[model samples]
Structure formats: structure tokens, C-alpha cells
Target chain A: MTKTHYFYIGYGLLCLLGITSPLLNPWEGATTVWDRLYLKFYGVSPYGGFSLLSFLFYSIIYTGFLYQFQLFLTDYLSGRFYYTAIRYQSLARWFIHLGWQMSYKAACFLVVLATVTVLIGLALGDSPELTVSVLSNLTVIQLLIQFLLNGWLQLMNGLMIVFITAWVFKEPSYNLIAMGLLTIAALPVLNAGGWLPAGLNSTAYLSGQWEDLILITMKLVVYLLIQLVVIAVLFKRKNIAFY
Target chain B: MKLIEVVNVSKSFKGIQIFNQANAVFEQGNIYGILGPNGSGKSVLFKLICGFIKPDQGDIIIHPSYRSRRADFPQNFGIIIDRPGYAAGLTGFENLKRWAEIRNQIKDEDIKRTMRVVGLDPDARQKMKSYSLGMKQKIAFAQAIMENQQVLILDEPFNAMDVDSVKVLRELLIKYKQEGRTIILTSHNEEDIELLCDQVYQIRSHKLVPVNTMAKV
Candidate 1:
């Protein structure tokens, strides 16, 4: 297989693992109740939505994203009107690519985690969680490892995405590069503070970290935006049509 | 219909002019070979026709629609410029899968069948990085034929092929022409020029001047 093919396969496997991890943690009767319900003690449910149905639902959505990603890659590589083969590549952009798939899922993950945090908070008590969830109260602490590792995965992914886009489209603007850095940097900060919840943040933790996290998030988002605008300007100058 | 036409074409590199007012014509269903001395811009002419490189002064037009550029087209066309581009790190199967649907010319099953025709492994379980130069050439050929395009551009088909491989390709090109496909191939092998092409375009004096018959050993 080609490196890109392996990259697709390997990345799919990693993303599959990332997606399935939640399912394992939250599946009922699969783990001890101690493992199942504890956000502090266990972590983010072994899955999502409190059931296999939930996991299945998210899996379907993820598969759609994955499918679109594959299509985008196909079209990006060989499809050209000049060449005339496939449709436009949606996952063509770095921000849209990273932020679109995992980041969006990460966003939904935060919302789900938030919603679960509140419901569980009402059902269980404050500080009720799992051990894996509790490995670090600070996601930034995990950023060096877990979150950082996630960021690192995304960084490599983003880098690869940008590299390929530039290679195929033959246009890699400074904005794209700058935006990529900003996304990686800012995304981790949000993850650190709490935009897209991972690790284990109970309701109590979410509330307290809200303000500082928001600030960090704004800084990152604005930097990301500026980079995007710069990219937009570059695209405009070069007459790049994203269509 | 005029299959290919170049008008008022000019080329330059780093303030050096190599081609000026170069023009040529290619008719449909003809197997044309390009021949030239080194630095005669033979490959450059092929690229300009294949839409890889643009001439600074003039434009090339492919007839029936009179558009020469691939970027301006609405339908399918295929090309292999200079050297083939492939992801050497992927499996042959996986790599083909990446390009199997080029221009929507071939379906997935057709691609698989083509891969099989070229003796590529069904599963393409081997990475292209590990492929020998011979294997890589075969894969490149498979990719080109995978999509049944009307116009096929091959810069140098005999780059690393064995004699048998070359023979196979000659037969394959003849078969494709029988099916009425336009193939524009360039090679240093005079035999390739003689055996395959119906006509030959020689890059002499920085221009494509048609040789009456491209058949001579």
C-alpha cells in the first residue's frame, strides 16, 4: 500500500479507536457499576448517551464524517475539472478538516460531557467520577500527555492535511500554515480549560473553570480567526476559489 | 475532428527562450509518438499538450471543443506526465483504490479488473515503497488504463520496463487505438516510435513538425 493509503488506514484505525474508547467505558453490564457511573472515579461513561444505542448513533455519524473524508481525499488527489474527475474536497482546508471531524466531535463531546455532567450531577453527587477520569484534574496536566497527545495527533493530522492540500491544489497560503498552528495551539488550550471535554471534569469542575477557560479559548479562537482572515486575504490575492 | 492543436505557443525558463510560435496538430484515433534530442523540449511539448505546463505566449486547444487545457474541461481526460506520480508508501491495492476512479472513467470493479490485468495483487497487500521499478511501472500502467479515458498521455512509458513489458505495452496501445482512444506517447526508443505511432511529431527548431510516417526502426 502507498503511504497515503496506510495513512488513511492507520488514521482510520486510530480514529476508530478514539471513537470506540467511549463506547467501551460506558457500555452497561460490560464494566462494574463503579466503572460505569463514576465521572471522577471512572470517566465520560464507557460510551455515550447511556446505552449501546447512543454509541451506535455516534458511530453512524462518525462513519459519515469518515466517508466524506475519504471522498474528499479521492477527489483532491485525481479529480480536476482541468483534469475533470470528482467533486470538490470539503475536508480540503486544514481548519475545516481538523476542526470539522475530530474538533467538531470534540465539540459535541464537550456538549455531551456537559449534559451528562449535569444529569449525573443531579443523580449522583459532586465529585462522583472514575479513576481514569481523575488521573488529572487539570487537562493542561494531561495536555502534556493525553490532551497534548491528542493535540499532537491532531497536529500531525493537520500538518498532513495542509501538506496534501498544498501538494494537490498546489497552493499553500501562509494563512493556512498560521491557521494550522493556531488551531493546534488554541484547541489544546480549550481542551485544557474545557471547550471540548475529555479526561474527567465533573459539573463542579466545569463551573469553576468556565471563566479562565473562556478567556484562553477566546485568545486561541481570535488568533485562529486572524490567521484565517490572513488566509482569506491570501486566497483573495491569489484568486483561490475554495469552491 | 482535429484531436489536438497548438497555436502561437512559446516557452521560456529563467529568461531563456526555448520554444517560439510552436504549433502542431493531432487527429483522433492516431497513435502519435514524439521524438527529439535531449533539451529539444520534447517532454515540454508533451506537457503543454497534456496540460501539465503552460506556454507563456500561446494556448493549445483540443478539438471537438477546441480547449487545450485540462482545467477548463467539463468531462474526463487522463495523463501521465514525464514520470508517474504515486504514493510509494501505500499498497498496490490501496494505491490503485486512491486513483481508481479518476475522472469517473472507470468504476471500482473495472479498476480491480485492470489491476488484475497488469498482474497487480488483488489485495494490493504489498506497499508500493517495496515495489521494484518494474512493479512500479506496471502499477503506473494499471492506473493509466484503470480509467478508460479518450486521451491518454504517457511521457515515457519505457522508463523502467523490461523488453516483455515494452512489448506488452505496444500491444496494449494498439488495442486502445482500435477502440478509438487518442494516445500521445513520448519516448527515446526509436522502435517505440516506429512500432506504435501512426504519426510522429519531431521537436526540431523548438517546434513540433510532423514527420510523414513515424514507422522506422
Candidate 2:
């Protein structure tokens, strides 16, 4: 990890804290940890009308650190890729290790987010106990799973986007195509709830239904698998010409 | 004893051929020098030998004893192809430690010793971003030799170094060769080729042609 990685983590903490502060304050809002989490993820609904500005703000903030990960991949490829790649006997192993690093970083960020949310709830004198909420009929385990899967899968999808774009465009500037696709997917007119990459990140698409959540999980897995397969195929033959 | 053989290897990028049926033999306990002008596929040949890139038409055969059961690339080979990939925020010691952890074969003491060998202060707190080009090159050279790799494939191993540093590295390369390690390298300077390399090959017209070292000078 580099010094810049710490900056990204710090930035993520600040963003989480800023967003959580208003929603979990003692004066006028969510009284419990679960309530705070539920409200935080209560993003725009497609069936109901959507707020363009609010969705855009949350989406960008949520996925901003991911752009840094993409940039890191690009830099590593250009610089020390050969240095590291040759240490391993096979490039496939190196690629797998890279994927693992991304996954680990993604999981760590989610943990940090959750930890901050809980700490804020504690400071606000919100109850530590996970309580029943009328916001949606989600059990504690189900809600936790939903939150984790949504956050992790979104980050992984973001990584997949970087790899696919790099393979196709062979340059970092091509990541703009990924950003544009994300923006286009955010529009509610597409009605692409949980199917498109951007729509899959929306909490509203989760819908608190076991069947819906399961379906969404399957869809996310399938989408991520397809993207991973595409990347593996393209990258298998790619010359290590990052420099 | 033959170590790595590039048998009729051919490669191209974007329809521009880099090598065509190029073949070379690298044997053990010898420092073989590759000489070619810029864009003449010297680096590409090194990459193929290291399995960083595959040849389009032929195989790069590695001796069975050097082949690892775990990976497609040969085991126990130190390599320097392009830029050294050190984290700018990390000190030289920290960077080496991270890479050493990959193989889990060396300890902190080994790293410190290797740093010392390269004339770097192991305890220095200076980050890699603050390092001079020469200092970075030393770090790159340190990592390649730290594990005592049996084979070293270095491209432009003498790049960006002072005269004294180059001399120190030359003596070290001779010591390594004395230990019976296979070393293949490329350098723009004929002095490096003449002083260190036991045999030399010059790349011409997509082929590896052995140059009579004594006659070339």
C-alpha cells in the first residue's frame, strides 16, 4: 500500500461520517443503528419517482474511491508490473492475486464504513440493539447481507469495469467510457433496476423482499462472472506492454 | 550446460514484426550479452525468456531442473525488464520487504544484507519517490539478486548509473557468475558487453546472430 491509499481511506471515512452525521443526529432523526443504516441506503426508487440530483450525488460519493483503484491498477501495470509478474511462475497467478487484492480492499472499505456508522450511532445515543423497523420488513441478518452484498458487488463491478476498459482501450483515458455508462444507467427512464451496473448499486432496487434480494444476488453474481470471464479472455493473450 | 533456448521464436505487435524465427542459446555459468539498436527486440527476447510475453511461432525451452511445478515461467530466475515497481510512498527497505514476503524465503536480515550489497542504507527513512534514478536502479538490482536466483535476465542492467556504481555492479556480476548462475543481459555500452559478457549475440534482421566478441571491437 502506498501513501495515496491512506488518503483514499481517509477521504472515504470523511464522506461516510458526513453522510451519517445528518441522518443519525439525536435532535431530529434515526433513533437506532438499524434505522440509521436503513435510511442511509434508502436510495431512489424506480417504481416511485426518482431524484436525479440525489441519486447522482450518492452514486458518485459511493463509488469515488473505486476510481482511485482503477488508477492504481493502471499505474502498477505501467511500472512494476514486470517486476512483480516475473516473480511468480505464471501470469495467471499474478492476475488472481491482483483480483484478490481488490476484493480485500473492497471488503476492508465496507468494514470501515460499517464501523464509522456504528460509532456515529453510538455518539448520537442511538440504541446499539438492532430493532424492528417499519421502513421495510428486513430481518437483521438479511439487512446485513443486503448491505454487504450491495457494497462489495458494486466495488467488484467497478473493478471489472476498469479491467474491461483497460483491455479494450489499452489506455487509462478509456475509463471515461465506464463513467459515461454508469451515468447513463443512473437515469430512471432506463428502469434497469438491479440489472445494469449502476442500477445494481441502488439500495432501492434491493426492495427488502427475500425473493427479490436472492434474484438480485444471482443477477449480480452472473453479471460479475460474465465481466470476469471477458476480462480473463482478453487479458490471457495481452502482451505485458504496459510501459 | 544449456539453460534457456529460444527456438525459432517469432513475435509481432500490431502487425509490426519484432522477431522472426529468432533463436538463441543461453548456457549456465556464463554472462551472455545481447546487443541491438533501440526497437530491435532485445527487450522482447528477454520478456519471452522470462515468460512475461509469449512468442507467436515458437517455444522458449527452459531446462527441466529450472522449471517450477507451480508456474509456467521458470523458477529461480531474477529479472529486470522495464521499470522497477517500487511504491513511491515506501522507503527502499519497506519496498524490498513487501516483495520478499511474496516468496516467503528471505528474512529482514537478508533484505538488509542485500540493501547493503547494493550500497543502500538499509535503515534510511527516505521513500522511493525521493530516490535518485541511480538509487532506484540499485533497488531494482537488489531485489533481483536478494533471493540468490539461479538465473538473472537483465535488460539494460547498466542504465542510469555512475562510473563507480557500474564498476561495483560489474565486480558483483562476476562474483555471481563465479557461483555458476546463468546471467543474460543487454547494454547500450560496448564496455559493459566487452568487460562482463563471456559471449555476445547481436540482433539483426529478426534473427539472433552470434558476434565474434574479439573481432567486433
Local accuracy of candidate 2 as per-residue lDDT tens digits, A1-243: 666778777767656655565632222445677766655654555654565544654565555656787678777877677777777667778779988998998888777766776787678777887862634566666667767776688678878888777757768877767766775665677644546766555555555578877776787788799998887777577566663
Which lDDT tens digits does candidate 1 get at residues A53-115?
A: 333333333333334444444434432222222111111232353345555554453344334
Docking class of 2: medium
Among these predicted structures, which one has the highest DockQ? 2
Of candidate 1 chain A, the 10-residue stretch with the lowest lDDT total is A82-91
In candidate 1, position A158 carries an lDDT of 38
Q: What tens digits encode model 1's per-residue C-alpha lDDT throughout B1-217?
A: 6887889899875577768898877788888887777777766675567554567889778664534232323123556544545665567766667655433445778877887776667675777767888787777677667767677777787678788878877888899899888888888888888888888878777777878652334
For model 1, state the Cα shift of residue B59 in Å: 1.1
For the predicted complex of model 2, DockQ is: 0.55
- Compared to the true structure, candidate 2 yields what TM-score? 0.90
In order, the Cα lDDT scores of the candidates are 0.52, 0.78
Number of backbone clashes in candidate 2: 1
